[model samples]
Target chain A: MLTIENLHAQVEGKQILNGIDLDVKAGEVHAIMGPNGSGKSTLSSVIAGHQDYEVTKGNMLFQGEDLAKLSPEERAHKGIFLSFQYPVEIPGVSVTNFIKTSINASRKAKGMEDMTANLMLKKIREKSSLLEIDSRFLSRSLNEGFSGGEKKRNEIFQMAMLEPKLSILDETDSGLDIDALKIVANGVNKLRSNDNAIIVITHYQRLLEYIVPDFVHVIFDGKTVKSGTKDLAIELEEKGYDWIKEMV
Target chain B: MEFKEKLLDSHLAFEERIDLSDAIHQTRLESLKTFEQKGFPSRKDEAWKYTSLNAMVLKDYALFPQTETTIQLKKVKKYFLYEIDTYKVVFIDGVYSPFLSDTTHDGLDVCLMSAALSKAKYRSLIDTYFNKIINKEDSLTALNTAYAQEGAYVYIPKSVVAEKPIEIIHFSTGKEKALWLQPRNLIVVDQNAQVQILERHQSLKEHVVVTNSVTEIYAHQDAFVDYYKIQNDLSTASLIDNTYISQEKKSNVRVHTFSLGGKLTRNNLNFCLNGQHCHSTLKGVTLLEDQQHVDHYTLVDHASPKCESHQDYKGVFSEGSKGVFNGKIHVDQLAQKTNAFQQNNNILLDDKATVNTKPQLEIFADDVKCSHGCTVGQMDEDALFYMRSRGIPKKEAKALMTYAFANNVLESVELPILKKRINKLIAKKLGVNLGFDL
Candidate 1:
């Protein structure tokens, strides 16, 4: 469903991703793991069309569409979602309104009318229940004073609402407790389908234990240095990243 | 001659026309003298440093309109808060339009300022409350006071609650080439009385009209007053609104000013808490684009002990628009245990759009809590990107952000219909229909 060849990207004057190649078919979960500043988040941002990162070389294709030519919103309209590592705090926008707008926006881009209020509300109720979110939580300002766990949960709830074809979870477990992490993972597991794909990007193998990936790619420095199965994640968990640095 | 000189030269003719009693006539004469001495404020003045009236005052405007222009009720119905029944005092081209007005005198008075000044029944209320709290030294207030005639006069009797809100609307018909207007309003809410008032200055057609309006509100013991000012007019029009409120023991007064239009707008909102346990709430939302400019100068005087004041103002500017906010809070020595808070936040959508905001606090009391903060910035890029990545286009995302930034201020609006109207107006100002009722 998605393909990248020798993808090279940079932000400002420095290169973040260089000579990286990846391929994922439908129904596959790909895990991208690296230490801090290993271009893990940069790769997600590059794919999501963040204007700051300039793709200097190579090409990315999603469903045969040139991904680099699309804006962030266009990428979203094409069923690409990025669960931010750090969600922004918008003080006056309610969660329900934000999600409604997001859904209607994509619908409008697809030349469709707005979703009926009743249908939208029904979908919101179903998704919020699936994510174990309180109804009151949907009415409050989006992430204004939300706890760390609540922010991540809200992101997952949005992903559930959008039902994107490809979901990028960048460090979704960093700020969650064990119970919240389990709940979040359960919600993600329920959203998985045979036609959709998710790229779980993390530094540790803890999240892999819950949402086990079919493929694991270790990115070192600015390139993907190794590709393996889930066993590699357990191996790296025990040995740490020193061995990967030695190989590089 | 300059506009100031024209105003000074025309006062004699203006005085000859009004039914001026001795006391009121003397006050006007004194105010005219003050205006003549000070003329218009200059950039050198500390309070006027950021805003200059030189461009506006350079050209001459007609002191009085040439004709008695009348507008049909249906033609200007949209300007009124007609969704709900309101007692309206409407004016056209500086002259009262009796056919367009719905004045009342049953138990409470919601009529004209001319009647209050000339008629014997309302003379005592006028004498006691009119011009009582205005800053006589200020040139613009003095100018409005000098030409004060024919505006709204609302008197709520003691312990009486006005059954309906009052709307004071001044509509300029563009009859003259360039017109200048001075409207004086007197509102006296007696002890335990409650009232809500909405005021606006609108230009019916494209014309150069400048309205210098002064309003004095007296909130007696236990009284509650809500005042809303709408400064959305044509680009050729301008408004200088000077509103003063004096609150007694346990009185609550709140003022909300929405500045969305006009070429040059300046708002001077002053509050004086005269007794203990008084509460003052002041909030505003300003949205400007093009070459428009708006300045807000606010002062809250805490004269008695145990008083509280809350002020919040938010502004959004795009293009070459400009904005200014100078908020000052003064706590007297005897006014202990006072809590005064002021906040001003602005977003500049364009690099050329500028805002100068300052918060000043003068506290003489030892045991008081007073805090003020001001911020001027552009929209958060990360927030913008986050919204865009959620599939909202850049323009719609910006509109939503600006709307959300100003939505909190509207939450305190007690009138639901008016809030909805302002909601539509803000969305229209941002040029987006977010597909849902905010």
Candidate 2:
């Protein structure tokens, strides 16, 4: 569903992602583990078409279509979703309003009518309960004055609402408690399907214990150094990324 | 042969052609003499430091004659009363047209100031408050009071709250080379009465026209009044508005000014909280494009104890437009426990667009809570990126963000229909449609 060939990206003329190649097919869960400066987050941001990152060289293809030419919004319309590391807080805009706008925009791009308010409320209620998000949270401004756990859960709630083809969770478990981590992981596990792909990027294997990945890859210095099965995650968890750094 | 000499020569020539009324002719002459003595305000004047009226004084604007002309009422209805049902009073070229007015509300009195001056009951009311709150030191106020030949006087009696809003539409239309219009209005709300007044000022002609308008509002004890001023003049037209509001005990007063179109526009709004527990809210939105310039100066005075005032003003400058916001809040020594807050925010879109925002707070009582802040900046890049990342185009994203910014003021309006109209105006100003339902 997604392919990257020797992708090189930079921000302010400083190279971040150099010669990164990765591929993911449908119905698979992939975990990319790396040290602090291994370009794990940069790779996700570049694929999501963040304008701040300049793609210096190489090409990224999503479903056989070149993704470099598309804007961030266009990439979103192509069913690419990025769960940000730090969710933005937009004051005076309710969560329901923001989510409705996004869903309507995506639906419009897919040649579908906007969901009615009644239907949307019903769907939101159902998904919110499943994700353990309080109904009152929907009335508050989008992520404004929200705690770290609430913001992460809101991101997962949004993922459920958009139902994108490829979901990239970037540091989703960084500031979450164990309870929140389990809740977020349960939401992700429930969302997995045969027609969709998931990419979980994290530093520790704690989150991996809940949402088990089928494959794990060690990233070093902007390049994928090793690829293995789920057992590789446990091995890296026991022996930190320094061991992988020396191997690279 | 100098620039000032040539400009004064042209001004005198235009001044010679103005024919004043018998009642105000003497006053007009004296005022013009005063204007000549004072001349146009320069940077030497404390209040005129930021706003220079030199350009206006240079252009000799011709005075519009008092004549009855057929106005396209349909266009007025389309723009001002598209969605609401209310009593409408229309004035064309500063002359009241009884044929164009619709006054059908119960216990409501709307009459021309000229006619009201003749009645025994309203004469004293008109004479007592006519230009009373406007400062004589203001050259523009003196100019409007001296030149105003006709105006409207509206009074809502005690214990009577009108069900519908009263709409006052002033249109400037003439075939003359240049036209000068002075419109005056005085609205009084008796004790415990409620009213909403909307004043729409517009000009249809492409020629240069100058509009000097003044509106005075008095809210008695326990009265509630909401006033909205919309200025969408022609490209060559200029406007100067002075609005004075006085509130009594436990009364609530709100004034919203939306400056959308004009070559040069200046609005001064002043509110006096004279009675205890009185509340005043002043909110404004100004959007200027091209080479347009808009200036807004607002003052809130807390005279009595426990009075409160809040002000929020926002401006958007694009292209080569310029905007100025000067807001001041004054808390008297006797007005302890008073809470006054003021903020002026601006967004400059283009490189050449400019904004000058100054928020002033004067507190004579140390026990009062008063805060004032002003910010001049570009749009939030992070917010813009976030919206755009959600599949909204850049233009749409900008419009949404701007709308959100202005909505902070719009949400405070109590009337739904009026709020919706103002929302639509803001949306149009931001180059977007009013598709979102609040």
Candidate 3:
């Protein structure tokens, strides 16, 4: 579903992602784990076509189309979703209204009619129920004064609504407690299907136990040095990333 | 002749029409002298620094329309808040249009200024509240006072709540090549009385119309007064509005100004708290585009102890439009335990747009809480990106953010229909269709 070949990216003349390559097929969950400053977030940002990051050497292809050629909104319309580590707080726009606008915008870009109000309301109700979000919470300002748990849940709620082809969860488990973490992981697991792909980017292996991945890649010094199954995550958690750093 | 000289020479012709024997005529003569002495304010003046009236004052406007012209209500019905029942005191070319006006005297006085100024029954009212709060030193207020004749006159007796809001609208039909209008309004809410008023100045067609208007309001003990000014005229119209309000013990008064259009507009709003526990609120929202300009000058005087005042003004400028906000709060030495807050925030849509904001606070009391904040910035780029990543276009995202920025001030609007109308105006002004009602 996605391919990255030797992706060398930098921001403001400072190289962050150096000679990184990865590939993932449909219906498979991939976890990219690394220590601090290991370029895990940069890889996710590069895939989402952040304008600040310059792809110096390589290209990212999603469904056989180069993402470098598309604008952020264009990429989003093309089914690329990046759940931000820190979401923005728009003070006066309600979550429901914001989501409706986003959905209609994407549909408009794809030359489709806007969803009717009734249908939009039904879908919001159905999806919000899955995330255990109350209707009152849906009417509040988008991420303004929201708790960390609410913000993470709101992110997954948006992912569920958009139903993107590739969903990249960037540090989605940072601020969540054990209960909130399970709810968020359960949400991601439910949204998994054969036509879609998931890439979980995290610094720790705490989230791997909840949403078990098919593959785990350890990135060190901007390169994927180790690729293994779920047991590698347990071993690294027990032993720590110092040995991995030494090996690299 | 120059505009200032012509105005000075037209005083005799103006006085020939009104009663000179009345005692208030002495005040008019004095104000006319003051206007003659001061003339028009120049850019050198600190208050008029950012706003230049040179271009507007250079034109030769007919101080009075040559003839009386009538208008059809059907043609101008949209200007009024016709969605609900309202008492309308409408004017056409500085003259009251009886056909379009619905002034009443049923318990409360919703009538004409000309009547109140000339009638024997209202002479005491004219003497008590007329020209009482206006600062005679200012040339613009003096100019309006020198020609003050016809506007709205509202008087609520003690403890009486007005059933419907009064709508004071001035419409200048493009009959003359260019025209100048001076409208004076007097409102007095007696003890425990309550009133709501909405005032607007609209020019029907593209013509040079400048309205220098003054409105004086008196809120007695325990009285409530709400006033709204809607300045949405054509590109050829300009307005200079001077409003002075006086609040007595425990009175509450709020004024909301919405400036959306016009060539150049200036609002000088002043409030004086005369007794203890008075609450005053001054709020405004300015949205300008093209070469349009709007300046808001507000003052709140805390003369008594334990008074509270709030001032919040927001502006959005696009293209080469210009905006200015000078908010002044004065706490006197005798006014102890005064709480005053002032905030002015502006967003420049493009690089060419400009805004000059200044908050002036003069505090002489030791026991006072006064804080002022002023900010001028563009829309947040991160917020824009967040919206765009959600699939919204950049233009729409910017519009949504601006709408949200200006929506907080609208929360204090008590009239639902007027609030909706202003919301529609803001959206249309921003040139976007928001997904939800703002």
Candidate 4:
């Protein structure tokens, strides 16, 4: 359901993702494991249509459409979601309001009727409960003064609400404790379906142990050097990324 | 005639056209004479440096005559605060319309400024504080004080708390070439009393009208007063308003000014904390677009000990508009333990849009806490990207972030109805509706 053909992207004149090729089918979880500055987060951001990143070469196809030509909002409407490494704190915009706006906008784009406030509140409560997030967070400003774990949990909760066809978790394991990581992984796993795909981006194999990816790709220096089963993530975590770099 | 010559001729004609009767008119004539002596201020004047009245002086705009086109009272009935049962006063073309006003309250007294000046009980009070806060030496202020005709008078007795807010609506309506109306107001809250006042300035015509107004407020010892000014005129209109607030011992005062309309607008607000333990808050928000220019200059004076004051003013300028904010706070040596804070933040949405913010603090007391900051910037890029990434369009994202930027100032308003109205007006001005969820 997702394909990246030798994607090359640059941010501020510096090439970060140099020739990244990846493919993920529905009902499968793919983990992209890499060290810092390995272009792991850049890959997700470029696919999500971040304005700062320029695609110098290569093409991205999601559901058989050119993803590069689509704006970020259009990409979102097309059922592509990126769980940010660092969620932005939008002051004065309550979580409930922001999520409602997003949901309505997406629905409007798909020619669906607008969701009522009562129905939205009920759906948000259900999602919050499923994600183990506190319902009180719905009233507060989006991620404003929230703890790191709370921010990550909020991202997972958003993913659960949107239910995108392809969900990319970019470094969701960072800044999370073992318990929070397990909860976030469980939330992602519960939302998985036969028609949906998941791309779990992480630096360590700790999150992979809970999410259990079907395909584990070792990304070194912006390229996927090794592709194997979930055991590849465990082997890379034990030996570190240097061995992968030497092999590349 | 040449524009400058015509302007001078108009000034001379206005001087010769005065028909003075009472002491108030005589005092105003003296102010007019003072303005004649000073003439129109030039760019040489320090305060008039950034803003030039050269257009006003050199354009030879025609002065509007007294308008008899009666305003339909029902046209403005919807804008009044219906939730609060308060005294309502209406003015059209700077003249008080008694037919449109209701004065049935026992503890509150509201009347035309002309009538109030003739009364013996309020004569001295009006004469003492009318033009005291504004600098008579300043030419424009003197000119306003000179041409001042009709206004409102609100007086609350001592130890009596007003049950409802007082609403004053100033409307300008005429098809004349150019109209200049001066609306003056004096509000006196007696000791230990409490009151809230809302002054809304609007226009019904598309004429090039100028409404120069002044509102002076006196909060006596232990009194609490909330004052709000909303200006939403047409693009062909210009407004210059001076609001002076003086707080006595232990009094608490809050002033909110929202400027949403007019082609050119300037607001000068001065607050003096004259009594120990006095508290004051001055907040203003200006939303401008389409070459509109809005300027707000505020001065907070901490003259007594243990006084506290806070000022936060924010502006959003788009479509080649310009915004200016100059806030000054002064803490005297006797005002020890005084805490004062001033912040001015502005967002410029377009490349051609501009904002000039200057926050100044002059503190003589070593023991006071005073801080001032100013920020002129565009919308947050990360916030915009975050919103857009969530399937919200770019325009909607921008509007959302800009609304959030101005929400800090709107949230400071204590009244919910007024807050909702101002938010709607802001959204209308910004040309986007984020709905009531904000």
Work out the TM-score per prediction: 0.99, 0.92, 0.96, 0.95
Model 1, A62-139: lDDT tens per residue? 989999989999999999999999999998889999999999999999999999999999999999999899999999
Off by over 4 Å in 3: none
For model 1 chain A, where is the 10-residue window of minimal lDDT? A17-26
lDDT (tens digit, per residue) of candidate 3 on A59-124: 789999998998888888999898988889998888998999899999998999999999999999
Report how far off residue B329 is in candidate 3 (Å): 1.0
Candidates 2 and 4 compared by DockQ, better number: 4
Candidates ranked, most accurate by DockQ first:
1, 4, 3, 2
Native contact share for candidate 3: 0.68
Q: Which of the numbered candidates is closest to the native, going by highest lDDT?
A: 1
lDDT of 4 by residue, A62-95 (tens): 9899998999999999999988999999888888
The sequence of per-residue lDDT tens digits that candidate 4 reaches over residues B263-315 is 88888888998999998998888888898888888889999999889888888
Displacement of the residue B142 alpha carbon in candidate 1, Å: 1.2
Model 1 CA deviation exceeding 4 Å by range: none
Q: What's the i-RMS of each model?
A: 0.8, 1.8, 1.1, 1.1
In candidate 3 chain B, what residue range of length 10 has the lowest lDDT sum? B429-438
Candidate 3 or 2, higher DockQ: 3
Model 2's lDDT to the true fold? Answer: 0.81
lDDT per residue as tens, model 3, B374-400: 999988887887787777888788888
Chain A TM-score (model 1): 0.99
Better of 1 and 2 by DockQ: 1
